[model samples]
Target: MRAFLRFKNSLSLAFVAFFATTSLVSSEIADFTAFDVNLTLALLRKDQKIEVVVRDQVTDGCWTKSNAAKTAVEKNLIIAGYENIVPADDNAFFTIEVSALGYDTGGNNCAVYVSLRAISGEADRYYMNDHEVMAINLREQFSSSTLLTGPKSDMTSRINDTLYEKSDELIVAINAARNSLRKKISDTTISEQKKNGLLSAFSLD
Candidate 1:
C-alpha cells in the first residue's frame, strides 16, 4: 500500500511540473493593436529613430501564474524589435485574454493593443501610417506590364506609376484632333480636287 501511495505521489509531481512549463510557454498578455504598430513604423523618416512601448492588459480573472508569461514576452520585445514586418499578420506579438479555468487549460483568445510615440510632436498617428518609413525592410510587390504601375512616386520612367499610370489623355487628344480635321473638311467649299489637297495638307492620311 505504501509503494502504491509513493507511485501516485510521483505521478502528481510530474503532472504539476508539466503544467507549470506549459503555462510558462503559452500565457500572454497584450493590449495593443496592429494598426498602432504599423502607424508608428510608417512615421519614421530616412534617418530618424523612434521608440515604441508595447504592453498588455491584465484581466481581473487572470491566473496568478500568467504574470510570468507576460514578463517573458516583454523581455523578448525589449531585447529584439518586431524586426520582421512580413508576418502572416501585423499583430504578431499582441495577445488576447479570455476568462478560462484550471491550471492546464487556457481561455478562448485575447485582443492586443500596440502604440508608438515619437519623442517629438512632429510625428502623429497619421504620419506614422501615411508617411514613408525607413526603419522597416518592406518587400516590393510584383507588377506586370498589364498592371503598369510600380511602387514609385516619381514617374520619370517608362514603367507605370504606383499611384496613377496610363491615363486616357492620349485617347482624348486623338479624338479631339480627328474632330477638328472633320470640321475643316465640312467648312471647305472647294472642288473635290482642292478638297483632297486641303485634306492632304491637314495630314489626315
Candidate 2:
C-alpha cells in the first residue's frame, strides 16, 4: 500500500512538472509568426481645430516592426509651444499598431498593413495623423475613389486584398477548385467498410 502511494505521488509530481513546462512554453515567443505591437498617437492642431490618427492599418506594405509603427503615431500629441493648463494625456489623441495576426493570409507571407488612427474634435477625427502613417490605411479605407488614378491605382495588390473582396461567384469557384483537390485526398483515405457505409448512407437518403 505504501509503495502504491509513493508511485501515485511521483506521477502527480511528473504531471505538475509537465504542466509547468507547457505553461512557460505557451507564454514565450517560440514562433516568428507571433509578435507584439505598440500603437502611437498622432495628433496635430491648426486653425482652431485638431487632427489625430490612431491604430495602424492592416493592409499590405506597412510598418515592418509593430512597436515602431505604434511609436510613430504618438508623435502627433507633442505640443512644445502651448499655453498652461495642460492635461496629463492631452485630449487630442491617436494610436497606431500592427495587426495581431496580420490580416490572416495563407502562410508566412506578411502583406499586412499597420493601422494608424488619428482623432480630434475637428473635421473627421480619424484622419488627423501625419501623412506617412495615415497614407498607409486611408488609401485602403477609401480605395473606391476614381480620383486616385495614374500608375498607382493600376498596380496589382496582394491576392487577398481584392480576391477575398471579390464577388460570391469567384469565391465559390475558388472553393470548388480547392475542394476538387480535397476529393482526391479523400479518394486515397478510403476503406472497404467505409466505402460500403458511404454508399449505403447516400443511397438510403
Candidate 3:
C-alpha cells in the first residue's frame, strides 16, 4: 500500500511539472510572436500611402446598417498619417483590408467581430546567380470582438466606434514599435551619420 501511494504521488507531481513546463513554453512563444509583429510594424512610414478595403457581413433588420464601418477605418488611417486610397494602387506601401460582422441579440444588445489585415505592397524577392527568383509579400492580421447594450438607434454608431477603436489600436501599436526602434538607434554607440542611416532604413525619419 505504501509503495502504491508513493508511486501515485510521484506520477501526479510529474504531471504538474509537465504542465508547468508547457505553460512556460507557450508564454515564451507568445512573447516572441509579439516581438516579431512589433518589428514588422516599425517599418511603416507616415508619408507612405495605404489602400483601404472593407467588407460588411451583418444581416439583421434591428441594426441600422450602412458604410459607417468603412468610413471609420478610413478616418483612422488618415489620422495616422496614411493616405487612404482605393482600387489597390501599386505605388502604395500597404493595403489595409477590414471585415466586420455584427449580430443583433434582441433588445438593444449587439455583438461585432472585426478583423484587419495589412499587406505589404512590395514583395521580398530572392535571386540566384542573376536569374529570376521567388518573391513573397508580408501580411499581418489582427481581430477583435465587442458586445454592447444600447439603444437600437445607436447600433450603427457603436459598430462604427468599434471599428475605429480597432484601427486606432493597430496604429498605436505601430507608433509604439517605431518609437522603440528609434530610441534603440539613438542609444547605440554608432556615429550620427550611421544612426541616421539606420533610422532611414527603418523608415523612422
Model number with the top TM-score: 3
What is the lDDT of every predicted structure here? 0.28, 0.27, 0.58
- Model 1 over residues 71-132: C-alpha lDDT tens digits? 34233333334323222233222221111122111343322221211122211122465785
All candidates' TM-scores? 0.19, 0.22, 0.64
RMSD (CA, Å), each prediction? 33.3, 23.4, 16.6
Cα lDDT over the full model 1: 0.28
Candidates 1 and 2: which is better by TM-score? 2
CA shift of 94, model 1, Å: 56
RMSD of 1: 33.3
lDDT of 1 at 86: 21
- Kindly indicate the candidate among 1 and 3 with the higher lDDT: 3
Which candidate wins on lDDT?
Answer: 3
Sorted on TM-score, best first, the list reads: 3, 2, 1
TM-score of structure candidate 3 = 0.64
Error of 2 at 110 (Å): 2.4
Off by over 4 Å in 3: 1-40, 89-93, 106-109, 126-132, 141-152, 200-205
